[model samples]
Target: MTPETNAWDGAGKRLYLQEVGTRDGFQMESVFIPTEDKIALIDQLSDAGLAKIEATAFVSPQAIPALRDAEIVLREIRRQPGVVYTCLVPNKRGAERAIEARADELNLVISTSETHNIANLRMTREQSFAALSEVITMARQAKVPVNVSLSCAFGCPMEGDVPADVVLGWAARFLEQGATGITLCDTTGMAYPSQVRALVADFRQRFPQAGLTLHFHNTRGMGLANVLASIAAGADRFDASLGGLGGCPYAPGASGNVCTEEIVHALQLMGYDTGCDLPLLLLAAARLPGLVGHDVPSQLLKAGQRLDLHAPPADFASWRDRALARDQPQTAVS
Candidate 1:
């Protein structure tokens, strides 16, 4: 295929963004964010016109105290008419709760590497997949679309390189078992642009009908770059967290997901239509520090957007005035 075919070029090409701040970002936090704050943030993101939002995850309260109130948060958030609110489901019980909470979509995560899988999920890869098959069945019965996020698809922190076929094979299994979409996650931020391009091209070629999404972390600082490469190579959907809030609690050296504003800012400047309100998204992101009780890792929050401008400093202005006065003619001054 030609290069143009992969790009969101010309007019009318729209890139879909799935905001995962509430679920992914908050999950890894040591301090628990209030349910009200979570609801408010979700409302803010929904108001920003994001196409999709990962609302929360259904897991054991003792396991992830930060997200223990998933049901309450999921139930309380004001649902936008066109926005899809999804939640992560770890197993059959989680899937049942997600179904009861009326989640618009069910996002299930499984690692491709055995070590990482066991570390994160507390189960082997095969065990996690078996559990996911049951979860997928439950989601199908409940009429809730399932989105399986394959973690460690790029490389594992422990096992190192996970082969391309392993990732594809896992995706194929999920699809066969009735998953509606696939999200390839760089759980430890090990993905590169070239690797992302090659994998995306292969995925599209092999699974032409499957809905594809890319999830990246900025741990290695390639999150946004990987996003561009993935999109340029024909993948459109992506997951980004506001203020770059989260990483895998189990994966060593893992970091927060790609920042939503940075992605939007970059893509908007490149002439792709995101349909997400960047200013509104920034407003939501600005609340991260207060809510999470710490400064977030967002580059956009620190650097400001592409058009945010500033005048010269006061000292520079004063110096410039003095220089102008000194350069003037002495006769004129006399």
Candidate 2:
């Protein structure tokens, strides 16, 4: 596509953002964020106009002690009318717990690579699908919408360079089995712009009615670039974390998920309506380092918005006067 034609196509269009910080971000934190703190963050995010928030995961406490208080956080948070509260469910039990906790949606995850799937879920691809199938059935019974996030969709740390068909095959299976949507995840930040564009185009054509969300990580610093490519290829939904606070243990050199504030800032500047309040998002992001007990990787939070102007230095007038006088030459000095 021509640059001029593609440049303005996404302008003035509506895009949906799924905030995965509290669940995905907190899961990787070394310290446990207090249950109350998690609730407060979710409440703040809800007020900030996030389209969807992955509040927490209903996995085994031993597996993910950081988010062990998932049910409590879900029950305590103030639910906004338009914001969807999603819970990541690992199995049927997790699905049951999520539904009991009154989650608006259930997000299930699987990987396209068999090795990665076995490593993460302790099962082969078929085994993982069988277990997830039970969860999907439970969600259907509970009348809750299910969105399956296919991890390592773009490439796998273990297997490397997962084929497009493998990713689409998993996505198609989930959609055929009653999933409300599919999130193509770059689990290790291996997705590039051209690959994202090609895959997204094929996905849209193959499943015209299926809902699509792109999940990216900034490990290789191409997360935002991949997002732009997806947008160019007609994918508008994405999963991003606050403060860029998440990484995969299985993927070496994995840093964090794409920062929510940074992506929103970029998209807003590009004229896309993300439906998020950028100022409020920054305010929430500013509190992340304190909660996580360390500095975060949010570039926007570190270096405010592009248009946030700064005044001149205290001695700027004297410096400018000296420089001006110096440049004027000695001819006028007499």
Candidate 3:
């Protein structure tokens, strides 16, 4: 394993990294990336020490044409030890497909707002809950762990300002139905830092046993701030895509997710151990533009690292020699 940077030397906290690039990143792209490339990307991510990877979604091809090859990808990708490969499932059928693919974990999502829920799933909140209960039961019978994701947990684009009580109530129901984890998703990037902190704290208090993960988009440029707030509120797991790839089709004007490199750099700087190698992650980010056939939105990919200072073209070798000499005080003195 590559040594982690002591960037967070004084912060004294450990953060978990969930690389959602394969699933979330590819979901929104208009171009089709070959399954071979996806597999290669997952392998690279696994080598980077990300504990969890959201590999693919078993949603309807009619709904998400991009993921039509979910089963093929799931079956073909090489699974590395210690990395959890998770797949998103929309309903019972999707859950069955995920199980058939032998997915390590299943993520089932439902929107909190009734209007958004209906619009997205073509079912009422109550109906979706009933469907979710069935899906959870199926996964349990199949011995698959289920992660219940409550989207629009912060504010809904359709209904606006979803009540905390509503989210909490839905979470309670999901847990009662046997969800092993809960992921609060800011689908449209409508969450603020304070709201994120308050919600995470409340949920942590309410569901002590349930593993919580936060998924935020950067549409409003508060994604990292929200992540910091959530971390302060005791959240360790978070979802981020390489180059900030992904946006909800239902959310108008919504942008990509928090960039994986940005999140890792932030956590590392704050003394949180993400177990990711920054240089390797940057390499992966650099490959994204070519694969997606367009420039990505990740800041780190554009600006490079703080340590990546450039030397003038003239006497570049001398500049390097001087820097090396400076590192060796006796040699510099000589």
Q: Highest TM-score, which number?
A: 2
Candidate 1: global Cα-lDDT?
0.88
Question: Which is the winner by TM-score between candidate 1 and candidate 2?
Answer: 2
- The C-alpha TM-scores of every prediction are 0.93, 0.95, 0.89
Q: Give a tens-digit lDDT track for model 3, residues 1-334.
A: 1122232242766677888878888988888888888888888888887878999899989888878889988888778898899999988899989999999999988999999988888999899899989999999999999998898999998889999999999999999999999999999889998888889888988888998999999998899888888876778889899888886676555568899998888778767788889889989889999999988879888898877898679979888998888777475556
Query: Which model, 1 or 3, shows the larger lDDT?
Result: 1
- Cα lDDT of model 2 overall? 0.90
- Measured over all alpha carbons after superposition, the RMSD of each candidate to the real structure, in angstroms, is 2.3, 2.2, 6.7
Poorest stretch of ten by lDDT in candidate 1: 1-10
Clashing pairs in 2: none
Off by over 4 Å in 3: 1-10, 250-254, 313-334
> Pairing residues by index, what is the TM-score of model 3?
0.89
lDDT of 2 by residue, 169-256 (tens): 9988888889989999998888999999989988988998999999999998998899999988888899999999897776555668
Taken over the whole model, the C-alpha lDDT of each candidate is: 0.88, 0.90, 0.86
Ten-residue stretch with the least lDDT total in model 3: 1-10
Count clashing pairs, candidate 1. 0
lDDT of 3 at 56: 88
